[model samples]
Target: MLLELLLASVLGFIIYRFVYGDKEETLPLDDGWWGPGSRPSGREDESIRPFKVETSDEEIKDLHQRIDRIRLTPPLEDSRFHYGFNSNYLKKVLSYWRNEFDWKKQVEILNSYPHFKTKIEGLDIHFIHVKPPQLSSGRTPKPLLMVHGWPGSFFEFYKIIPLLTNPKSHGLSDEHVFEIICPSIPGYSFSEAPSKKGFNSVSTARIFYKLMQRLGFQEFYIQGGDWGALICTNIAQLVPSHVKGLHLNMALVLGNRYTLTLPLGQRVAALLGYTERDIELLFPFKEKVFYSLMRESGYMHIQSTKPDTVGCALNDSPVGLAAYILEKFSTWTNSEFRDLEDGGLERKFSLQDLLTNIMLYWTTGCIVSSQRYYKENMGQGFMNQKHDRMKVYVPTGFAAFPCEIMHMPEKWVRTKYPKLLSYSYMARGGHFAAFEEPELLARDIQKFVGLVEQQ
Candidate 1:
């Protein structure tokens, strides 16, 4: 049996209240201050500063010493990843990380792009701003904001940035050259973690919106997956005029009553507004959808209620953190990868690439803060929030990557986004779409922008 890469069980409400009404609800764009203690007197600083990633010998030596001492537990016979990262295979990764992995080289790769920080809500907001190296005559690059989700950082967009910014060099048409801004959500990587409570996606959207204004973009395109998807949606909601277009690879749209007919709805799917592809991807509901959802959600349950407790060990032990985080990369990339002895981790991604992501959490010690976001967002319960009850009025485009943990039908997406202009069923890829399939994602983004530009 092959396991599909599991979704962030952090997706709220196993038994969601799937209701739709004619209320025409809109999101309230509220302001916030997320610093520790009470809000400080006087205005918050609004200066932007250039930043670079650097690693020292002391950091490398400390990491090496930790890896050398990781005690291992043995896995049961041929368990593979059924029981989580097989400890047997982890030894291989440990050996590579301990003996061959190069943090300094990866740091250099990270710094290849321009990075900057600005204070938003009293927290240092980190983001990368990429401009086309050369522009055609009389052309201005389009501005875009790409937000990252949990277990992922701005690094995921590195490969795709050049493809979008300098498409002419990559054999793609130069119709949509872009100036891209990829931001680190507060409490992730280089972005300062929120010291106070209630720092959910809404605050994040406001902060990123402020970031765009600080960068002098009155309006821009927004894209994301996982938490990034929700943040982009909130950005559209909070300030629809400021968002020119919204693109996503993941959505948290809870299914309405019609979703329950999935097992036998294949034959009558069209009658109910579902596409053939939706039926093909969603049917066999028990194995592919229900059980898979249940199997993958343990982390969400723990994170939503006690993220700090679960993340304590993860923050303390790098190997443990890798096991916890990398397991998602394996199972989520392609569920079938779970059966391989090595979890088939490198099939679509290099260890260097994967470890660099892990290093972000390890170096920043933001695991607990990152996990707490789930608690802050979902601990209060799903569908009970203001944004959950609203619809995004912005023009939207969706890249439905075939292997995405769950399929978001066109009709389903339209319920949340009234003006969905483009919906493409991608030929390949999964949850971490940008990281695994840059060209495909980039092309999809370009295609969506083309459609948006025309309208």
Candidate 2:
């Protein structure tokens, strides 16, 4: 008993030191040139140019031809989405896409927002800038940058833009009107893909910081999920002074000693600082955390290790790409959807919106580039990156969506973001918070902003 007690005390002390002993450190603010060929000797053009989304008849024809030629294997009997995207339901989706879906109309919708491209670090970064349609006298809209993640584009923010930029029209308060900037992570959509290697989240964050600076913003708020969450987190770590506040719908705070205590059971977890909600979301540990990750993370393993090989196959076949990407939307949004025939895709999203997102990847021929991001960011392994070890100092807000792929407790988030100011248990939503539940996410953002301003 004495020996066991001694070992426990030593282990506890080690964990305490590892989690709380380190002095705050900032990730090195590095620079990179992602474009093909050697870095240019001259200065990069800083002009922000207007851009529009356009589609040709040939593009439409090709898409239809590809859809018609797609030869999908029949799904196993009653498999639903458990084994993957149900081919039975995929046929229904393809019929609508080929017959009812209008690419031209979708293109126009994409162009509704003011799209712009600027050359940053030899790459043309694409983003949409939306300002408040109406603002009270002497009230300037806050500049907020909302980034998109893998298999998603800036299109994800369309629903939430109006709520943030013109709240009064949407039956919400205008106290926090925002001039929103939704940028495509380079190589995702319209943004030019990096021709060279070693372009990771930190590099993207630096380029975005420069973009914000060129836009004349001294300080701004940032928000994101998935890869966006990591990129935004890097921005905060790289330059906390320039980020007025940080907001995230998802966070990557696992892979630490704290997570190792889960097997100790709920009684001990509560003593380790996990709340009841955390316990509820995390218990049945074998099923929720362990098996869930094992089931859902097959794509991550593929993307991180051999993205290019699969990217080639996906980028070539539109049908293959849709299945690959849409499967994530279905599972990540609500894993339980896997039990449904249609994957419950339309429960919270429309075919038009979902297909529009897929079209961005298809039209831009950027699937390969987008998949490479996983390799660049995670190829080195988890918690191996310098930024992973550093805690964010800027005021941070986190919205814990109930159906998110993994539930992050406030205790876990606080370890990485020591200045966390707002932590809300969102009523309803999943991975795609803005796309799935815009009002809920917008309200959380406003609440977090209010807290930051109060501080």
Candidate 3:
């Protein structure tokens, strides 16, 4: 009995150290953000065409055909054995993707929403621009730009677009309608992969700021999660003049401040899950986020240092692609299914939906490019310093997800965003909030934007 207790204590101490010991290392910058001109070139021009939209039947049909072909030949089921996955027994995921995965159906579904493309800073940016159905009735929709993170695309917003753009469709007030524009981050999918080395988060932020200006939106609201949150915060700092407000999932630099100031009890609570009061105060769900981070985020550590080494394999092998990307679908969603083959894709996302996202990476040959984002950004420690927070004057709202890799309590977040307005503890959802819990995320965005618009 005493030995067992000693083992438990040692295990707990190790986890606590692993979680809290690493303060972000400050790396020397090669080239700082806006070393010359802080302000991005160009202003909103009334005559500039916002975007070129081509929803022709023939083009849409070809996309559907491609989706059909992908469904016919499903991904290899060798992720466990090849990738050294802990579990030996794999789920019947292949049968589900082949038999049940409806790609043509999903393409038509995605095409139902309007799509647009525009050039900004020598890159072609793809986005979905959904306007409220009642715009002709003289109610102007608030323009909201939603950005997706790594391993995600503009498709993440498909579920939440209607809920935000046409609130009445969701049985919500028409007064809360929004004009949502979700963009694929550069190098992710449809958006052009940057051909240079210095295209980090700050650069993406600046280019996106230009995209917004080209769209004729003088003022706009911003929303994002993961890498999206990092870019959005940079936008808030870079173009405070144009961005009216900012909302984010997975707060960044804010975590740094918590390590610097919060009380010891709160710090311990943040690091190790101990106090019921802290649990009640922070996350409502009793999910084990730390284990998933350790297991799933091994890729992040690799990508940070030697992205090219692993990225080359993914770039070459289709089976390698499935193992690298699809594995996250299992562990990141929750702790209970950490070893499951399907990774609980069916629980929150349809087979077709999940496969489509994977296919986007596959078809674009962007798996390598996307992983390179980590090398360019983290390898340089941009997030640790260059992208550090300034005094953000714009209104801000934050939705704290229950199963996110990290938690940033309101008190901790205030260290960076001193003017924070809304902080809500999300009842449920993981890191991929837009894709997994779109309705809830959409509603929260509308509620927060409604408050910002009113102000």
- The prediction achieving the highest lDDT against the true structure is 2
- Candidate 1 overall lDDT versus native: 0.86
lDDT of 2: 0.89
* Per-residue accuracy of model 1 over 1-455 as CA lDDT, tens digit each: 11222221112223232443544555676778888778898988999999999889998898888998899999999899999999998998988899899999999999999999999888999999999987758999999999889789999998999999999889888899999999999999999999898899999999999999999999899999999999999999889998899999998775344554555546777678787788888877776777777777889899999999988899889999999999999888777777898887988899999999999999989999999999999998656787876778889999998877778888778867879999999998888999999999999899999999998
Show how many residue pairs clash in every candidate, following the order shown.
Answer: 5, 0, 1
Task: Give each model a TM-score.
Answer: 0.94, 0.95, 0.77
> Best-fitting candidate, measured by TM-score?
2
Tally clashes: model 2.
0
Candidate 2 residues lying further than 4 Å off, grouped into runs, are 1-20
TM-score computed on alpha carbons, candidate 1: 0.94
The digit string of per-residue lDDT tens for model 3 on 1-455 reads 22232344345434433653433322122322222235355642223234432234564355445434432233346553334332322224444544565555666777787776766655667787888776656667888899988778888788888888877768866776788878888888777777767678878888777778778898999999988998888888777778888998877643343332222344566565434534554443222323334455678778888888888877765445654666666555554554445456567777677777776776677888789888878785432443452445678898988767666677656656766888888888888898889877877877787787677
- List clashing residue pairs in candidate 2: none
Model 2 agreement with the true structure over 1-455: per-residue lDDT tens digits: 22242345345545545775757767888778888899979888999999999999999999999999999899999999999999999998999999999999999889999999999988999999998886668889999999999989999999999999998889987778899999899999999999999899999999888889989999999999999999999999999899999999999876445676776788999898788888888887777777777788899889899999998999999999999989989988998999999999999889989999999999999999999999999898655677766778999999999888878998878878889999999888899999999999999999999888887
**lDDT at residue 158 of model 2 (Cα atoms):** 96
Cα shift from native, residue 263, model 3 (Å): 11
lDDT scores of the candidates, listed in order: 0.86, 0.89, 0.66
